[model samples]
Target: MENHNHTALISKLLTCVAACENCATECLKEEDVKMMAGCIALDRDCADICSQAARLLQRNSVIAHQYLLLCEEICRLCAAECSKHQHQHCQDCAKACMECAEACHAHHEPITQD
Candidate 1:
């Protein structure tokens, strides 16, 4: 991938990571924490995957492309879950996840085995 592309994708991934983390933290503070369990779990999973994807992209790892595919999937799932909530943090996280998913989809490249 090109340097500029990598930078942009990494930025999106990191942004998604922050959004996911924040959403999870905020969800825990909601009055009905049990009701937000699914959202919280997806948020944490999305954050972890996005963080890893960003790191792999930063180092130009050969597996980054493949890993991004997984990241995109997780982002979409997270977005869907977040969109179901009315909280401001959840809405923000949904937007971030959707953007990150789009970025990952746009940047996807065929993986070549060494």
Candidate 2:
């Protein structure tokens, strides 16, 4: 029985997952895909982390905040990689990653049980 209001976090996580996946695929399509091997790898890793984080949050895991922190790190890494590329896809992915990062940061705030 999860709170309906928290669905927004799930949605943002899903968006991050999709963006990272798409960025990896797009990187592979580039003419110099070999040069972006690291970026592609990071994108895949980020996507996986985002998915797992979302799953943990959806399940209301007590330690979900840790996963969200991981997701933020991965998204930042992916965004930095994508920002290095000049392709349109990379630009779009960077924007998405940035948004996801911000959302994760906002959602991970500590709740005081006063």
Top model number, TM-score: 1
* Candidate 1 lDDT, 1-114, residue by residue in tens: 545448888999999999999999999999999999999999999999999999988888778888888999999999999999999999999999999999999877766677
Q: Report the C-alpha lDDT of model 2 over 1-106, residue by residue, as the tens digit.
A: 2443658888888887888788888888888879989888988898898888888887788667756777887889889988998888778888888888888887
In model 1, residue pairs whose N, Cα or C atoms come closer than 3 Å (at least 3 residues apart or on different chains), thus clashing, are none
RMSD of each: 1.7, 3.3
Q: After superposition, which runs of candidate 2 have C-alpha atoms over 4 Å from their true positions?
A: 1-4, 109-114
Error of 2 at 105 (Å): 0.9
* Alpha carbon lDDT of each predicted model: 0.93, 0.81
What is the alpha-carbon RMSD of candidate 1 to the true structure?
1.7
Q: Estimate each model's TM-score.
A: 0.92, 0.87
